[model samples]
Target: MAKQKKGEKAAAGGLREQLRVPAGPVDLTTYDTRATPGFDGSKDDGKVALEGLGAEVSDWQERLFAEGRKGGERSVLLVLQGMDTSGKGGVIRHGAGLMDPQGLKITSFKAPTPAEKRRGFLWRIKQALPDEGMIGIFDRSHYEDVLIARVRNLVTPNVWNRRYDQINDFETELAAHGTTILKCYLHISPEEQRTRLEARLDDPTKYWKYNPGDVDERQLWPDYMDAYHAAIERCNTPEAPWYVIPSDRKWYRNWAVTTLLLETLRELNPEWPVPDFDVEKEKKRLAAT
Candidate 1:
């Protein structure tokens, strides 16, 4: 596959190539999710993958907090978008579980309230943006305006069509404001989703997770795929590139997200700034006390 030029729309072939996953439903049986010598999420190698990822996150968190103390505010925003039963919840649970909770915020967006709908599609979303020195994770983000709304025909063609550019501008503004945006679309095959959905129905403990509406949504898989293709093509910008993560193997998905996040945070070079205080005066004050 040819490399997509910068600013060029990502074609279906290019996305599949970049993600390193087969074009259709993947057979999870062929791949190993267990921690091994090479794979990051293997449980057998003392869960080395998870431990290393956790350490990397901790280092970044320390730097970010130090920078925060110094009054240099840098923020990170992670957007996760995917189909129903695509392991978005699990990814949030395991992937973000290692990060410092005090420095991180997770917001899961559901259907908008009547008040929110009265505003703009992005009104509620922009309100959730991360503050400086914080990491914000969106379980389902603004992409829904383009994806589900398009799939379900909730909005007019012209309205949803305009959202592609709207989203790009919104993200670019975030990047300009010293917020690093990492967008990931958890790619899973229909079969994998079906299996997971079935597991939810069969287990009593997981039954609460099962929703009848999911079946209706699955029926429109083709529509969703088309919407996803268009949304990624239109909205993936140089400043905020979308990563299509192969999520059939939960371990791989976790490792990929964690690694990407660590690398992005490391690149920001978060550090503690110098305090504005007179050392001698402070010491004298302490002595007097």
Candidate 2:
């Protein structure tokens, strides 16, 4: 998709335009996660946008729950795939903060357990699949098998290549079972990532977030980029289209994610069914009792 000009209307024709960024390094701090005109991070405007978006999310969630109670067969699965410092955690934290905890589940996939390793690569992932009337967010998901494993030479090229078909089939099965998969790739530049990493090291409260190994991963940036590009090209399907979110600007990432999720939930149009009961009859029965 071609990059979009800033401040354009967000209709279908404008969607492609929204994805574009200006050439060269974009400033990360100028965008505000809480603001609608996120290009400028005004606190008051940001707060208003955040509150409005939060209210909309809450409304949709309530409707979804009601629809689920009425036996509606709908579920949403959001997969967040990115490099080590790509702000996946931050996006999940802020974008999903407004959701009802009971209706949402987050799964962060790590190195496979021994039992998982013995089974197919997708075995562990299937266990985290969302049930009806819920949203499931996967932090680092099944794509790791095709991406990191392939980049690190942990799997044969043939084995990793086959995972494209495997993942597509898995997602197809989910769609058949009323699950809609929304995948997002947070795209951050190397320099922006370095700044975040340094901030983690400098801030005492965030010291735990600093892992020296993350720096090591930075060395293989090109390899990982290649892996991600290939994985996205091969695995992005009609059942699950991947949205490449530009993350050099953190606020824009948050806004884009929130907007996308809101749009998706709204499209579901979940609603509560009217209860089948006569108020007068109920009142008469209560009076007799």
Candidate 3:
């Protein structure tokens, strides 16, 4: 991953290009959660890079919003999946925080209630979709069906096994209908996760964010890793790709995700759209008044 060009966007190659999970059986074990894959800078330098991207990210988001208002069906949906304390919240707060909230939809999926369970996994997900011309972020997403559902044995092997194909079909439909999907698996080491979770317990203000159940889930790390590996492999397609963000370092995580998104939006090249009305006539009318 090389530095971006000054006046031109290196949308086709660079950090974003390297982060994407290739099409095949992905071994999460081999991915270095601690390695800052594309970034060769210090933590402070990463922070500066992220700051530089803010205005550009906002501009791109506004253009996409305008494109939607002008009748373009295109939009973006970012799906985030990872182990607990993998910095998903940090990404939203720091990365997505740079964009306009009105143009963004953020959904945090929790354990389904009885009513939701009756309707099926994606039922609740469908309702949270971003409107045309909007960008959507899923803090946790539909992949929970295969991840948690499989690990916890909430669904039978035969059932969860079939969900991979179902998810692919669902994403295919969304892509065909004018949505660009970017799914990210935040890669964080177990050691870092423990440190973060412990810090949460130590800070009274952060206590509310900690769930004891997360400790239970830690015991199933190998299983969850397997689940993630399968999910990434089965769902990684040309239409929608998965990017594994090395998230042990929060600064690097923020920089990498923001960089990828900036490249994506730039490639989309959303325009501010021509006004349907006559601009000169409107200007004349205003001037006369």
For candidate 1, write residues 105-190 as lDDT tens digits: 88999988889978989999989988788889999999998888898888899999998889989989889988889888787888
Residue pairs with colliding backbones in model 3 are: none
Clashes of each: 3, 5, 0
Q: Indicate the residue-level lDDT of 11 in model 2.
A: 70
Give stretches of model 1 more than 4 Å off. 1-47
Question: What's the TM-score of each model vs. the native?
Answer: 0.84, 0.84, 0.95
State each model's C-alpha RMSD to the native. Answer: 7.6, 5.9, 2.6
Q: For candidate 2, lDDT tens digit of each residue in 210-255?
A: 8898998899988887787777777767777776777766666776
Q: Judged by lDDT, which candidate is best?
A: 3
Task: Give the winner by TM-score.
Answer: 3
Candidate rank order under TM-score = 3, 2, 1
lDDT of 1: 0.75
